[model samples]
Target: MLALAGLLGLGGTVAVQAADTPAATFTVRQLTPETALRAVQAALTHCRGLGYQVSAVVVDRAGLPQALLRDRLAGAHTPDVATRKAWTAVSVKMSSAGFAAETQAGKPMSGLRGDPRFMAAGGGLPIEAGGSLLGAIGVSGAPGGDADEACAAKGLQAIADDIEF
Candidate 1:
């Protein structure tokens, strides 16, 4: 009987120790500057091939710019728009176009567009790998949002194998 009680007490102590353990940190994967530049370059190239002058921006997981590229003939407003689009994608872990569709006028999330950094555009895409969000890429100044999004997708495809691990 005493041995059983002792074992029970030991088990309780172990449980207490486990419960007291502190969860002090978490791990996150982010893209490197080289990878970001590769993405932007590929995006820009794709847009150029399509006869669209555009700006592309890559943002880290924290929604900070990692790399930006603007074609020679891109509009002056493109860089800013591209940056905001990347910011919006990383901030929400979703494509900016999907957000735009889901948050259009009269939708429950429509108010999200009111945020200065939230761009309801199609050119933004989350950069994901092995189920993790590594970053985002955005392209602007294409003839339309669909064209812009295609350029961004090309950018993501350029780095797909590199980030697959």
Candidate 2:
């Protein structure tokens, strides 16, 4: 019985040690400056091809704007809106459509929609690599959210080789 108790104590100690020590740390890879710039340029090209003046924004994993560009004729609010949309996507790690669906279903997003820097619309896309979220890209002022999203998708596709998704 004493031996059994000792074994149990040893097992408990090992379990506690394992729990205290982290097995691994998770690190998310982010987009490089060149890749981010390319995404913005691609967005611009796609929007121009559709004959729409638009703004494009790229945000880092933490939802901070890294790069932004607006067409000369784009609305004054285009840049800000695009940045907010990008922030929303990066924060949520999902497409704006997914976020909208969740919001519409009455899911709580920690008041993200109420935050000044968040946009729940469908013009934002999460930049992912190796099943990890890197950042997001948003396009705005393209006549409609779908149009803006399409342009953003094209931009992401342009950098598909460099990015994970």
Best by TM-score: 1
User: Candidate 1 versus the native: TM-score?
Assistant: 0.87
- Report, for every candidate in turn, its global Cα lDDT versus the true structure: 0.93, 0.86
The sequence of per-residue lDDT tens digits that candidate 2 reaches over residues 38-71 is: 9999998899988999999899998888889898
Clashing pairs in 2: 129-164
TM-score of each: 0.87, 0.81
Which lDDT value does model 2 have at 149? 94
Superposed model 1: Cα runs more than 4 Å off: 1-17, 20-22
Error of 2 at 82 (Å): 0.4
Per residue, candidate 1 scores C-alpha lDDT tens digits across 44-159 of 99999989999999999988899999999999999999999999999988999998998899999999989989999899999999989998999999998889999999999999
Steric clash count of candidate 2: 1
**Candidate 2 error regions (>4 Å):** 1-20, 23-26, 108-111
User: Model 2, residue 65: what's the lDDT?
Assistant: 83
Taking all chains together, the TM-score of candidate 2 against the true structure is 0.81
